[model samples]
Every structure is written in C-alpha cells, then in structure tokens.
Target: INCSFQNSVEFSQQVFVHTSGSPSFSSDELEIVEGSILGKHYKVEAFLGEGGFGIVAKCRDTTTNRAVAIKVNKSDPDILQQAHVEIFILEQLRRLDPDAANIVQWNGFFHDGERVCLKFELLDQCLWDYIRDRNKQGLPISEVRPILGQLTNALSHLSSVGIVHADLKPANIMVVNRHESPIKVKLIDFGLACPASAVMPGEFVGTVGYCAPEVMLGLPYNEASDMWSLGLVAVELATGVPLYPSENDYDYLKFIIETQGQPPDHVLDSGVYTEDYFIGD
Candidate 1:
C-alpha cells in the first residue's frame, strides 16, 4: 500500500493480491479518492496534512458552500479510538461554550465505512508554518505578546472545564487572520487532549521539544504541563528557535539540566524512569 497527496488532496493507491478462493479487493484497498463525496455532504477538495493517526483534507460543505476541514482516521483500532475521544471532547467543549473564538469550531462527525471523519471549520495556516515563512527571525514581541495572551486565555478556558490540551504546540495552533493587525489564532488538534482528572500518572503524551519536564520524566502532570509547553512556544516565537532543541529523551533531560539546573532531588526521585538517566542520589 502507498499514499500521496497532490494539490493538497489525499489519495491512496494500493496493490492487492488475489487468491483462488478470496475476493480480489481487500478492505484496506478502499480509500477516499479526491473529489469524492463524504458523509453525503462534504465535497473533498484537497489534502491538507496527515499524521500518525489520520489525514486532514480541505472540503466544501454542499449544504452551506463553506470551506471546512475533514479529518479522516486510518483503519487502525487505536487511531479509531482516538478519533472517538477527540470528537467527544470537541462536542463537550462546544456545549460548554458555543462561541469559543480561541478554539477550532467543530461542525460534527460522520463515519465513512470503517473510517471516522471529523468536520471542522477551516482556518488559515498553523503558527509553525507562519513562523517559518517569517524567515525564522522570530516575531516581534509586540506580536508574540498578543498570541501568548490569546493562548493563555484558551488554556484557562480548558482548565476551567477540567480539560487539558496535552498537545499544545505551534503546529497545533491555527492562525485565523494573519493579515489583520492583531492576528487571531485558534487551538486545533485535540487528539491527545484528555480530561485533567482522567490522565493517569506517568502517561506519555505530547510532542518532543514542546513537552513539559514532568511529562518527559513520566511523572504526574496536569494543566500546568500545557503552561510549560506554552512558555517554550513563546520563546520559539520570539527567537525562532526552540528553547530546548534536544533530539531525544536523554538529551532533552540533559538540555533541561544545563539550562535550568538539576531537578530538585524530590522531582528526580518522583520520576519513574529517573534511574535510567541519573546515577545514585
């Protein structure tokens, strides 16, 4: 099986083998072709992006003629479970605040055979790409301040609702209106998000470089973890470089120690995998 994107549209081409007693086409051979109709409402236009769990596409809503994003999950069971969780969290957030300007707008969800497709309001590029286009010179503090303020407010709102955006990074944040003076932004990609109280201690989550120390150490974490990520993002936006550009777990811990000093004995002791990196106390 192989996959590729053209014109921002996702297409999959598969080669299959046929047996004397079996069907020529297998379930995995099926794919959402470009220009295909989805949910009987969305007209697939272009592929937006893809991740380990799913692919995102730009589509048009036939009912409203509005541009939207459709996230189509792979047929893997774990990915399907995440898709369900994301949909549930978005629905709950919508119920809590119908007009959350700082968060991506979730239209609804539907299933395309075994695949789950989530519908969302299409927004502009992500902050990661936006910052890259700015020649990686880092944005002015004047601009960075506003983006941080809005993100802080969004995080606060999530905390109030007992939700934690486990994955908070530049790429997960969408820029709404880049041409405007005060650029508008919205948080997207809630696949790794979960209820603050539901997350078990030492659960691995979030992306590297942006992941919080507690998370990297496999310790219990909460909304504060997101704050840690936000702080790193702010620095990246201001300097166009990651504060801790470690390549792996050991290096990440080393960078943290070098920049912030060794963790307090208690913090190191609390980490489940501390002994792997640290010598005797």
Candidate 2:
C-alpha cells in the first residue's frame, strides 16, 4: 500500500489488481452488488447508519460467527480511495495497539468491485447515544466518572505515543460494559484521524463541533488538536449537553470559538496551528 499522501483521489482511478501466477485479474474486470448482502463472508444483521462516506451495517461473520460492523465506502472513486487510505491507517494503528479494550479490532478488509469494505468490532452503543439515554434517566455524575476515567486513560496513552485522534467526539467513542471490572471506552473510527506528527495539507478533515481551531484554519496540527476535541467531550460528559450546539458547520465552529476562545499558546507551540480559525459567533 502507498503510505505517502499524494492526491489520493486522482491516483485511485488507476487502481488495479493483478495476480502473478497462472492468471491475472484487474479490479476493473470484477463486479459488485450495491445494497445487497455480501453472502457467505458476512450475514447482514441490520443497517447501522448512513453517512456521506457510505453505509455501515451490523453483520455476523459467517465463518467465525462473530458480530462485526461493516463500513462500505461510496461508489465514487475519490471516496473509495479515501476509505482505502483510512483502512490502511487503521490496520497500522491496530498493529501498534492490539489490546481489545483500547481500540476497535479490524477483522479484515475487502473490495467489492465498486466499493471497499472495512470490518470492525461491533459495539452495542456509541458514547454519545449512551450519554443521551442516561441523561434521560438523569444518571448522576458519580456514575459516569468511572467511564470518563477509562476514556481519559485511553487518551493519555494515545497522546503519549504521539497519536492525535482528530475525531474524539462522543459518537466516535464506543461503550463496552462487558463484565465491568472497569468500564471500557474503545476508541473507534480512524477515518478522520491522522498521525500527530504528520502535517496535513488541508484545513478541513474532522467533525464540526469536535474540530480543533488550528485544523479549521488550514494550518498544521499536532497532539493539542486531540486535546481540544477531548475538552469538548469532557464538557458533554459533565453537562450531558454538547459544549458547542449548532445546527450546521459554520454555526458549530462559531459557537465553539465564542465560548472556548482560540487555541491556547501551548497548543500553537505544537507547530500545527494558526490564529485564523474561529469556533463560533
């Protein structure tokens, strides 16, 4: 896989697969079924959700009978290439951290003619949904502390290793309460995450409310970007409300800036930032 970030969208059109021995086949020669069960490989249980990227479905791995979440990329070449890059990055990160409690396990990846599929461990609920439901019951802060602690530890570990999870919102965090010696907050979805040390050429990449100020300004970014997102998560956990409440991207960013202020000097010192970004009105 090409690790270097070129214009992935342009290069994706040239993607071809070949077999060295006996016979060779090109990706163009293969076919795919849209909105159909993949069959044999995975049994589709239910639809999970849909996003601009593609559809996610809860599936049972037929061979192992294990439940997994399958994310199917859009048919567009650019989207498909972006998904491939995401899967590759996830595979590398999983190799670095194999502990099931820390991150989502990537079962496998495959291409279905028109799209790429990523198989991830399926969790019952996302952190955001869990908090919303718990809030309806008016769960005490004390009850939620333990869950928050575990997540903080995960963030600490990732940050220590120089990995900044660009998208650290409630939805990206998964809640797994199996046999709770300690509640687990498995960090899932690396589709928006990038290496903390790498300099991103673009200004936009992450979710609106969760995006760091530096990221929105089209500047470089580092670990502090993740911290900013974490701060938003902390606010949500503490109040059961989003720190920046806005209906759209522009409004969301405005809300954050007006309240959170600009990124602190310590954040800018990380060398992945600029002052041009604003969070909210």
Backbone clash count for every predicted candidate, in the order shown: 4, 10
1-281 per-residue lDDT for model 1 (tens digits)? 12111212121212111111111232224376678887788888988777666678899989989989998877777666566667656756874553364888887777787888888888889999999999999999888998999899889888888888888889899998788878888899888877776766666778778888887786888899999999999999999888888767788878888888888889889998778878852
TM-scores for all candidates?
0.86, 0.75
Candidate 2 residue-wise lDDT, 164-244, digit = tens: 667788888887663354557788877765556554534466777777766665567787787788877877877788778
User: Which ranges of candidate 1 are over 4 A from the true structure?
Assistant: 1-30, 98-101
Assess the local accuracy of residue 269 in candidate 2 as a C-alpha lDDT between 0 and 100: 55
Query: lDDT per prediction?
Result: 0.77, 0.64
Steric clash pairs (candidate 2): 220-272, 221-272, 253-279, 253-280, 254-279, 254-280, 254-281, 255-280, 257-279, 257-280
Per-model root-mean-square deviation over C-alphas: 9.8, 8.6
Model 2 scores a C-alpha lDDT of: 0.64
